[model samples]
Target: MPVVHHRCRRTEQKAEELTNARSKNRQMGPNTLLAHGPYDPHSLHGFVNPPVIHASTVLFESTDAMRHRKSLPYTYGLRGTPTTKALEDALSELEGADETILVPSGLAAITVPLLAFLGAGDHCLVVDSVYTPTRQFCNGTLRRMGVEIAYFDPHIGAGIADLMKPNTKVVFLEAPGSNTFEMMDVAAVCAAARAGGAVTMLDNTWATPLYFRPIAHGVDLSIHALTKYPGGHSDLMMGSVSATAATAAQLRETQMQIGLNAAPDDVYLVLRGLKTMGVRLERHQASALELARWLERREDVAEVRHPALPSFFDHALYARQFSGCSGLFSFLLPGGFKQAATFLDALELIGLGYSWGGHESLAVAVDLSDRTVAKGPKDGTFIRLQVGLEDVADLKADLEAGFAALAATAGTAG
Candidate 1:
């Protein structure tokens, strides 16, 4: 007679339910799918949230079970717990990916795929306006390792093909690139990368999956900083790399080999945040667009770099690709760093900080000195703003004060 463990049977049953749910989830709207993603109340004794399983060890039923531990749901905590699986499964669904892997921070999401797909002799193409940390890693680590790195214009589009060498293994993209918010031709870049036999990866954190799904548009791996909108709060730090069927194995293998894992508690928080992501993002988009419009009209503002705004250079491209906009965007203030400092010093409600996609509004003075190309207006101070879920009227008043302070500064200089 053969023995069947209750826990193992339960795990198998749960996996089946999740697989079935994923198919049905594709039919639901983003908001509806988010609420029901991969979490079955019936399976967990009528609990709405998945249980956070803090674990490092797995108990086996017998000699056969121990010998074939690979067949089990989870072998160790570092591999994943129920909590981690819940989040990963949800992200995979949102991203329209075969699998989604977790890491400690948003930057890890970028580095993991780079490491997975590139080697010493391989060449990589990165957007000129990529996140500063990504550029730093390529210049420092990837360069030191003998990987040939090249930066390209964010708007290079299908022209990226010209830069592809025989060894170009990866082409990294960040649309509405970093602080300057320059939009890219995502589909064109991905297609060119595919034709060149190079893997394509995009930092989709700014748009989240709700606004954009990278895999559907030929991207092999869609990267996100779950610490932002997915966490919806400023408390936790985590990142995710969602991969298509072609890239999933490599992404997962690299993550496992590197022993990378997000904290169970942080994963749980992000799962909860996902349920409300749609609603929070609505407020964020509406508020940010309204603010960007107002900034564009002000005399103190030189340029507003929000893709959603019609005044933007790539507004048509942004309109064609993105269904919605996020709260993070930048504006150029007239004058230099000193003038930017004065404007920030006047802000009372918007915090002087780094990172966006939180419940609270934040602003930071951007330094584009490291950029080799696509450097923004050299004469003005670039200020990136993360519009929070604050009252739009109140946010306007705070900025009004900032402009007033600049006026006072000019008066004193005279």
Candidate 2:
């Protein structure tokens, strides 16, 4: 395998320029930054969008250039292209980080940071409410690598200090955790990790940089699954890891070592998605909150676990930390998995699927039995919904149909 060095003067200069520009426009809101910060239309002959450059081989102009490939802006496609750089720049700005690296998927975004920081004999404190795949990776691969992994309660907050050891290298967190929607005190957890000499990382996919800036909250690395909200169309897959200056080089080196790179086309699509993410997320937030409120009034709903709702246990924390919420949240049905299946089967507008953050509404049955520390809403069947840009009235009507199915199921079962 060819080793491509990423510490090129040209690349650094471009990134520095972007960073300087961002500093000058500190008062600009997210929407304005998303529209114009990372891209320069004038540089590309006044084209609005960055050109997608598809290339694996970057030829040197002379023998001297070939010898100094490490100093050049780009030596190979795997290192990065103009398309990749554009997205990275935009995401870095959004995340409030010094740099951002792209990966093949959201899971990779999580794994890369772990691999970069953890080694044999090291310990990792992972919140139990994390994305299931992330937990699996830690238990399976990290354990096999001789790294000790511990699942701590999502609500542990400052108490995370007790769980840390001298060998602890990373404290992993997912705010308003997966499926269960339990929020963590991010600043508190980061403080604990920092005091214990452990790096703090967060999966910021749900809130994004628009609602929650993880780096600003003292996180060392901010990870995002661009597959969801950033893709916005369900047509692409990519993930990003944005890091502070102290950790950026290590992340980039580990990424290069692992040969983790997203496709150029996928990078372009995500860049396109980022442009409209702010507006799309606003719709998602409004529709989801409206739907959550409607579900709260229903007699069949056992519980609504949306952080944006005042009823949620962590609503106060969410209010203080997050600027807004996304479209994804979970609700509990009255019965077991049977009732949940029936409810899903009855939905007309909401599609039953695995991934969200697209233009369409989706619902999935969630079972948290595998969770040891943070078993969520175990009394009833959990249903996670991703509200799309559909009309709120229509979405409410769709859920009304789902509830009708749940009621019919109960009647039949009785």
Candidate 3:
């Protein structure tokens, strides 16, 4: 009896500790939360990281248990496991969402909620400067499904209300938009959507939750390409859609109906990556801003489109919306595709690639012909840069080499 009393007392003490820890967690800053927000090491045999549970079928204790499968936190591997839940919980907290659903890829995150909310005869407004894949999906699949799509200027702001019809179901936004880096008036647009009884979804990948929280600003759904900043490494591919309490159930149901699931190992990688996102973003913000500013001063560069830069057209709006900037930005050279290619080919450190947010810097020559509203510089070609964690000085030197090669080639042509 004495031993039983002692064990019970110990249990009570541990329960108290856990409660206190959770209370403290609620008040901790972002960096601290990243390190120790949702995971409980004590609950998992003191393991620092949650176990990667690879599962498809879960065994039940009896017929009664199988009958009441819905009562269990997990029923099947594809539905979810403790591994996926850990990452989901972490992302939910980060994104300020009631719940977050993981998908196989970033584009899946964009499509799931879109497909869930919009149907035949529905009208959807997508920002003109959205990610290329999103535009393609809207034009192809969504349109083919009998949905009417309108591409609005990123700078439309409250003017979006003019375009809203009674059938308008979704307003999609991507601030500091893909390639061109055009900043949107997120709050104004969201407010306009709300007034028109439309749901607002923003692709928040460029400004991760570390820099911005869209839900707090009236966004119904916040989409993230976890393959980018959340994975931290270029090794994994995944996406997540975080929804407000009002929209969570619908978003979740859509994800389930579509049979969407991220690989357990990739989910684990994102979980590990979340712990260091704050620190990694800090470096990305600092280095990218430095590079943007440096490029602005160079005689060869025509324009630099980094929202964080004071000279940028939407700097004030960006300052109001985001806490900080990410490593992706673009600059322009005084020539078209050929000159851009010459410069990129000459670079030794920055690789020419499609994806960004990895540890290594990448550069791409952007094609702006697809845009209807946000046009790229006509006098020059835009070169998008994904400034990585490398020393800013080295990146500058590498860029200088590209400029030298371009100048030499141009002189030979003359």
Best by TM-score: 3
Worst 10 residues of 1 by lDDT: 1-10
Runs in model 2 with CA error above 4 Å? 1-23
TM-score against native, each model: 0.95, 0.94, 0.96
lDDT of 1 at 271: 93
Residue pairs clashing in model 3 are none
lDDT on C-alpha atoms for all candidate structures: 0.92, 0.91, 0.91
Cα lDDT of model 2 by residue, 1-414, tens digit = 122234344455665686688678798988998888667664554578999999999988999999989899798999999989999989998888999999999999999999999999999999999999999999999999999999999999899999989999999999979999999999999999999999999999999999999999999999999999999999988899999999999999999999989999999899888889999999999989988998999888889999999999899999999999999999998778887888899998899998899999999999787799999755788999999999989988888898888787677878
Better of 1 and 2 by lDDT: 1
The top-ranked prediction according to lDDT is 1
Ranking by TM-score: 3, 1, 2
As for model 3, its CA RMSD to the true structure in angstroms is 1.8
Shift of residue 321 alpha carbon in model 2, Å? 0.5
Query: Candidate 3's C-alpha lDDT?
Result: 0.91
